[model samples]
Target: MTFFLPFSTVARLRFGSASRIHIFALYRWNY
Candidate 1:
């Protein structure tokens, strides 16, 4: 479980940045 926790956190960090960029672009386009 501990190993899974680290992997999940890393995945979240990587994907989270991309997801934030996508969301930001969508928001900017709406404006």
Candidate 2:
């Protein structure tokens, strides 16, 4: 399980950044 920790963290960071960019695009579209 120890080896899986870093993979999960990296996936979470990537997903977080993707969602942030998506939200930013939507906000720009609305305004």
Error of 2 at 7 (Å): 0.7
Task: Give the clashing residue pairs of candidate 1, or none.
Answer: none
Give the count of colliding residue pairs in each prediction. 0, 0
Q: For this target, which candidate reaches the highest TM-score against the unseen true structure?
A: 2
Q: What's the lDDT for all of these models?
A: 0.98, 0.99
Off by over 4 Å in 2: none
Candidate 1 lDDT, tens digit per residue, 1-31?
9899999999999999999999999999999
Off by over 4 Å in 1: 1-9
How does residue 18 of candidate 1 score in lDDT? 95
TM-score of each: 0.56, 0.75
Error of 1 at 13 (Å): 1.6
- Model 2 global lDDT (CA atoms, 0 to 1): 0.99
